[model samples]
Target: MTKRSSRLDDAARAGWLYYVAGNTQDQIAVKLGVSRQSAQRLVSLARSEGLVRVQIDHPIANCLELADALRDRFKLKFVDVVPTDPGSESTITGVAESASAEMERWLRREQPVLIAVGTGRTLKAAVELLPRMDCRQHRVVSLTGNIAPDGSAAYYNVVFTMSDSVNVRSFPMPLPVIATTSSEREMLHAQAMIRPTLALADKAEVTFVGIGDFSNDAPLYVDGFITAAELKALQKAGAVGEIVGWSFDSEGKMIRDITNDRVASAPIPPRETSLVIAAAKGPRKLPGIRGAIHGGLINALITDEDTAAKLLG
Candidate 1:
């Protein structure tokens, strides 16, 4: 092997041990079977050679200030604002990963608590980032039905994926999120097969949901779950956002729309002491997030710094 290539490999190993493994110089030296001075030199060399790239996972002072401001403004229970780069819009948008960390924190608790989850791209992305753990002590339930009107499963049903990650017992509502009619939804909700799931969903103290912005790019319309006319009707009814397929207006009140009437998903409004955390970000979601906060639909929030600033603005 070339001497240069060998050195590069050593530097990479040193970087991984010191950064990823959270090892001190003494520990790294012992593990690498080298003197502490040599280990320190290796770590410095790794940084100089660009083998070490440390990314801070904790929120910076600016982000913490933003979080505190949002919480105070809305009288919320918890808030996390992921740091963003002014020049790099893409780099600062890891809200899903940050939310996943919060989810992990709650799941790691020894007490077995009921966790409810909503469906969307945001939630699916967060579930995908979860590290597998033995969390069978807890229970997880879906806040929305798993199917579309066409009988196909919803594209972003997240409880199953979350169950796989944490080894938790999961209950998924097998019906469509929005039935064809109010009567159909009533019939679906009344079914004995779905009763247990709905009942359990009602008891969840910790809930994670995705905020859907009412815009030209609304996920319900884009995913073919709701027709263009239905979307227009929802917008006309003053729906600024949706959670668990229930459309709400700027004041956070459920609008008088057929969409809300036909929704078969478990209707879980903010309960006393319930922790409902919504993960959303970007310019389009500012109004929707504001609406959710105004209505007390979500007591906790996870978002990026850019969106938080826009919401406050």
Candidate 2:
């Protein structure tokens, strides 16, 4: 073999001996006929060259305790509780960063994958934090409409950002957030181009979404996607929060009102999706997050420690 290849082979061996076999540098040196210092350098070289990887499996006590409580309370498949200064903006940032790391790991899977995404500020932040990679084997589909009434894809559009970050194809739902009428929504759903994307969303292995509280400060109203009167009506109808434009009550049952029919994007039934991961944080989001969990809208969650405590309570 060439000198470079031979050196790499030796480094790999040294790394295995020191890390895996629990051998000292001196022992590695004796086995490989190298000096102790040379063995140390070889292990370092192995790590720097990506021939070896180290992982700490030790769990943080507080975080693990909170995670366990949340999982048990909500019957959640997975929960990640990130430490944050309570009530600070870092609450959102911490959750978003953790969710971003999880997304990167999921995208690294060797099998072809489809990731459905929902729109919201937290979800957008997670997408922005995601590491850039060229994952052409994956497809991203939007679980919400791309446009608002004012012809803007401004805040509640994350599919494009995800596609750009990962360099993959994205299928945005080409419809308005709230169609003017039920018939219009039906017509939009019937379109040939829209059908396939919706079908793809139904079969997605994993979906990332955000939970939105149904107060006056609701994103739909604040972003001008819904009128003040509409927000009031939703609240009157016993809505507590929204998931993918569909509002639900505190008990997690869909509030089937006019708004439900007017929503263009069809809600992906939680049972249909293998994994529904919701990333959210903050006191304002706690009610919505709880509603989602109670309703079985999401199986996994990523949120800050404070929010996790609140949810557990």
Estimate TM-scores for all models.
0.81, 0.79
How far in Å is the alpha carbon of 207 misplaced in model 1?
Answer: 0.4
Clashes of each: 0, 0
In candidate 1, position 9 carries an lDDT of: 78
Q: Candidate 1: lDDT of 250?
A: 91
Tens-digit lDDT track for model 2 on 178-224? 88899989899999999999888888889888888887889888988
Q: 1-313 in candidate 1: lDDT tens per residue?
A: 6898977677778778988898998998898888999888888898776555444666599899999999999898999998765666442247787778788888899999888999888888778777778988898899898887678888799987776657988899898888889998889888998988888887888899998877977988887778999999889888889998889999999988558888889987355656899998877777788899999889999988888888788
Candidate 1, number of clashes: 0
lDDT of 2 at 3: 96
- The stretch of ten residues in a row with the least summed lDDT in candidate 1 is 84-93
